[model samples]
Target: MEKCRASSRIVIIGAGVSGIAAATRLLQNNFHNVQILEAENRIGGRINTVYFGDNVIDLGAQWCHGKQQNCVYDMVKDMGILHETGDYYSPIKRVRSNKEVIPHELATKIHDIAVKSMPSGPHPVVGSFGTHLAQAYWRRIESELPELDRTVASESLNTFAKHESSIIGADNLFEVSVREHIEYHECDGDKLLHWGTKGYRRFLRLLMHVSEDSPEELGLLEGRVQLAKKVTKIELACPRKVILRCEDGDYFEADHVICTVSLGVLQEQHEKLFTPPLPAAKVNAIRGLTLGTVNKLYLEYGKQPLPDGWVGFFCLWLEQDLTELRKTEHSWVEGITGVHMITCQPRMLMAWVNGPHGRHMENLSDEKVLEGLQWLFRKFLTFEIPPPQRFVRSKWFSNPNFRGSWSHRPTKADERKTGPWDLESPVLGEDGHLGLLFAGEASSRNYFSTVHGALEAGYREADRLIGHYTSCSAKA
Candidate 1:
């Protein structure tokens, strides 16, 4: 604590979870001169909750992924925020073109088989996930399960792949990295919890600032945040200091700057964003790592009864040929993968949009989206459903601030041994002074694409600065 410098001016770019966490941690460590610059008017860069009809919907990040090792889960649980566990074990109905509900047990069995068949070993990232998946499936079909119907097995594989791709937020499995996918950090349990839009927003508020009425309120990180300050350029050519210029023509100077912008944004603006171009190593890492979109469409229907115990409406495109669907570029709705029926809020249905399809979905009007969904449900389900009273779409891909939802596994083209560590390395001045540090989910090696990963990244960078100042203060 003696190494703490209250006068050190630290500026954080982007008010996402990583940025917010970094700011809060700095303030906690007695770093008083800190400022947070946010591109959007509101906080929670990717963790957004929107309201529609009578219910609150999480348009952005929805789940804790795991309970035990997850930092986000621990904090929310301690706060006593209301959330329900996702029923992955719950029966997924495979709807036939003739409207037959395939037995739940059969569907679960297929799911289990698919999970067991995930390709293991050192797979090069050169080819897409789809290619690896096809090879893996063929091997499994021929060697392991020769007795199973080929068509049924293929459909099951497609369903599972589509779901997994949505989870990765990739445009297609082909865009995913097989190596990175294999290396991802897996948490303790399969348990997932969703904090309704309002609950999540409250959680964000708690993370960013202290409450006035609460005795524990520190209030150091709250008012320092400046919203809607889109940082266009970061000039770090100077040895001792760096300057950040915003889109709104405002300028801020700081001894150390922590950038928490999304990987998508960095991909789009890396060359122009930095005054001195980034190192080829950093550029290659950025190009090698991919950012994927996972948008959600919320619909409110008048109290409809879904399956008895099922929490989700899984749509298996049985009518469409999997090969043909994969080949076609115009088949955007094919990516309108599944709908999550909220058990807590009965009337709401959240449809998932992944990758390039998410951008395509954003182009269509609300009526068109509704029409497509209606047609899809009518073709699969036995029940004749009424039109949704209202609908909201999350256009994360198109949002300039976000560009995409989250980071995905790196492709083979990225030769760097460490996936995101290359990006996480600090940019230094001529004098070897730390001018900039990167903190975000994309920059995290073990926790990429998770909120906890982002939070940890924020803390990591804050600590880096603290350690530096501590050593300097001691020497002085």
Candidate 2:
């Protein structure tokens, strides 16, 4: 039985966390004939980390999110690699585009009230989170805040909306389903766990069972992953086998195939990639689920602009300023919700942008982006800031392999009546064997858009295959 399981060939598409997790679990279960085909030249898909200036910066997935019940946290919690990032709202500055500095105490109070106003559980009524939040927030503001502070509080809420949009990977909260937003299960413990200088790539090493102190190496996946193998076609109609044809003209046959491509890729390539076409339900789910863009701009300064112990700047734009900016070339600047100082790198700052504005930012030249940032800083801050010595920006929306950042449950998801379950279901071959399976963060119902969710999805598929073979062998 063990030998039979070892001989069963398996091919996994994408070398992201999900794919790597699936491969690792399979190899551990004695499935020796496993291969991972990554379209990019690198192993980690969206978990890219690069050295900038004096320290490493993650261009992709940065934090561990939560500790309790998080598989990624469980693996590295005691390794001394995880760093607890205290309250994200503390030691911060909130300034309006009109050059009005909000008091820290008042800003914190408004922020707390705004957060409390948001729905914490699934609403019995079906509606958009934006609508519900707006109504609730304004109601609280009318009763709780003084009339003089209401305008600033309203602007602050707008800033909070942008930040929430970036986190949910939505252009606006109105596009997100209120019920689905609340359905997402957040793991208990610290919500922001940083890897410090190690970067997210360290998670990959630990998955391969490689020690941090040892020489950097891909322990189990040394020769198993083929980079730059973009699979353009998948022939699943074959009697008892599954065949994958790559753009490089290389092909492979496997007893079973696990696809861990991002939701964005699936939405773009599902029709051309599959042989007999994906089920209508799966296709509908793909269309219904939204993949929104979240981009980052990294700026390295010759001199630090912010004081020590300062978290970052939250840009609250007055309605008049925002309206005027929307009429000019600097409209994309509105997408930038906040500019945060890198945790360990004192001279570096990171700006976050989301939605259509993120896509627009990708099309602009670096010089233009810098100009916009300079204009934004000047409008909001009282101090004069120097130009960045070096600049780096992420273009996840423009990348063909990844059309956008992450998935979200859209407002129309309920109407479509299709979801992650439809995507996760396997297609059976003529011989009644599982020929094609799906695994990715998007397929995780409760934990979509999370790295740990991706890992869990991978383990789920691998266990399914293991259980299938085990049952079959018992009957034999």
Candidate 3:
């Protein structure tokens, strides 16, 4: 039996933020024998950015949700990376379903109110977020508020719901937790730092910096990362040693393995991937969590698409019945939970789709997707619109490497009442030796479903091993 060495053979599964963070931390702590096995050829798991001509299009993560307290923000900001500040309500250009052009001042005011006045406390009678929202709107309508106030309030609430639901990645609002509606890690000054051409992938390379040779020195990390290496199985009968098998017939042995694969993948392949099966708790944790889909539709055009210096388009169907519209099959635009025109990039427009609609939209041909967008434009805009020159889209749900975009508040019956701790807990063998470990945004209790959350989890898992092994070595 090969003895476990803290400095040798630490395998990290997945090349996402969590995996990369883990590998870097291990190296920092003098554990050089680390290997990163990424399924896809690319590095960043969900923080992917690509270019269309001169414009930068982020098909995955686009913003640092909270800047002041966010680690991602701290790193990027310190690096002097340039980005634009943004939010849900863009005043420069927008189109609502009611055909009303909302003034920038009014839009900002309404957005502020809606965010500050989010309904507090759990809804005992209303379990679903959709029902809760409906009830709240009806209650407001019954109030003595002025007609203008009511209109503004209605639009604000609807906009908030749609935007937040997109962030949650749940198609049906009812599926979202009424109690857990507010994200726990939401920091003060909820600033949205939009990454332009710099792209979020900059952070992956930033995090990989370990050697003192130069800022760009990632020779160790670059060599350790094996892209296109899909881990098929993990044989862990030996307490001090484990073996990993890849689809390409390559094999590797490691003393410890950190499984940073997304919760969605774990739920799908846990039974088949682990040898002798995981314990009931670990299996239950995987089952209990929910993985939601979020897709983006990127459309590019030649020259200035809209009015001179105008940003992007925003289609807020204020009067449309969202609940009924979601059930419709023909309205492909309806599948899009929200649409935003990139203010910084005038030639591109992006639409966000969540829930099952995300999957449906991704499966459609490029022509079909464009047709749906056109239908939306004709319905919402009063003026004639031109077709886009080129189009691309995201299929995070359909992609086996990432079954879903992010994690969401799981249904009560799906998860243990103790919360996401079990989901993040290290999967240990029956003999009480640590055999497998877990880390990801889903595993993070405070920062779940955020890029920083995933990074923090990776750092935490690495620190865990650092403390455990280093302390043991000292005693020995």
Best by TM-score: 2
| Candidates sorted by lDDT, best first | 2, 1, 3
Error (Å) of candidate 1 at residue 371 is: 1.5
- How far does residue 132 in candidate 3 sit from its true spot (Å)? 4.1
> How do all the candidates rank in terms of TM-score, highest first?
2, 1, 3
| Winner on lDDT (2 vs 3) | 2
Please provide TM-scores, in order, for all candidate models, with all chains considered together. 0.90, 0.97, 0.88
Model 1: how far residue 307 lies from native, Å? 5.5
The sequence of per-residue lDDT tens digits that candidate 3 reaches over residues 84-198 is 5745455544457755666777666555554544545533422666666666655544553334466556665666676667877776666766555643567555556766666
Q: What tens digits encode model 2's per-residue C-alpha lDDT throughout 1-476?
A: 22378899999999999999999999999899999999999888888988996788888899988887898999877779899988875556888887787888888888888888887774544788899889989888888875746678779889988888999999999988887777888888888899888889889888988778878567888899999999999888656788899999998998899999999999999999998888788889899998899999999988688766566889999999989999999999999998888788888889999999999999999999999999988988877778999999999988888899988898888778766777788888776668999999899988889899899999999999999889878888
Which ranges of candidate 2 are over 4 A from the true structure?
A: 1-3, 146-148
Report, for every candidate in turn, its global Cα lDDT versus the true structure.
Answer: 0.77, 0.88, 0.73
- For model 3 the local lDDT of residue 195 reads 61
lDDT (Cα, tens digit) per residue for candidate 1, span 4-52? 4798889999888899889998888889999999999988889887766
Off by over 4 Å in 3: 1-6, 82-113, 121-128, 144-159, 210-219, 308-313, 316-329, 413-415
